[model samples]
Target: MIRGVRGATTINQNTEKEIIQRTEELLLKMIDANAIVAEDVAQVLISVTNDITACFPAKALRNLDGWDYVPVMCTKEIAVPDSLPSCIRVMMTVNTEVAQKDVNHIYLYAAQSLRPDLSKS
Candidate 1:
């Protein structure tokens, strides 16, 4: 079986360091929460909202984990009206036996507002 874990994070500033740190922090949480090991991950795709182009958030994770083995891709989020700015989002597809309800989905900072129900806010 395969499941997708969704997560998001925000940066207070548009600097490269802020982008990298916030992205790394959120991804680490997402991976830990869902018990996602390297072997289980099929692929990771990251998108940063239009306001963000300081860096590719996925690279931050790769650098943090020393992940020379994982495949990662990044793209710019679609520019929609009234969208949250400075946001980094990840969709990780993993091979897992866990049920969808048992999987953890992370939403942090302003992005949390989008999935308040899931976050139990």
Candidate 2:
């Protein structure tokens, strides 16, 4: 079976260093929580708020030890009025035996408010 693991995180700045670091941190937590393997990931779709323009968040995934071949795409999040800023969201589709209800979604920093029901913190 295939399932989607969702996660989000926020950054204080739009620098490449900040974006890459936070994105990598979120993805690592998601992988650990879900027990996901690089080979099982079908694709990763990352969306960042319009305020973030330093670089693609997908760059973080590619830097992972075994994720160089994983498919990753990055885009801009929709500009909703009064929405969260400097946010990066990720939807990772993977081949897993885990049931949908068992999947874990991670939200970090200020993004936790975006999904209080799903956020572990």
RMSD of each: 1.4, 0.6
Colliding residue pairs in candidate 2: none
Model 1 segments more than 4 A misplaced: none
Which lDDT tens digits does candidate 2 get at residues 1-121?
Answer: 9999999999999899999999999999999999999999999999999999999899999888999889899998889999999999999999999989999999999999999999887
- List of clashing residue pairs for candidate 1: none
> In angstroms, what RMSD does candidate 1 have relative to the true structure?
1.4
- Candidate 1: how many backbone clashes? 0
| lDDT (Cα atoms) of all candidates against the true structure | 0.85, 0.95
How would you encode candidate 1's per-residue C-alpha lDDT over 32-56 as one tens digit per residue?
8987887778889999888887777
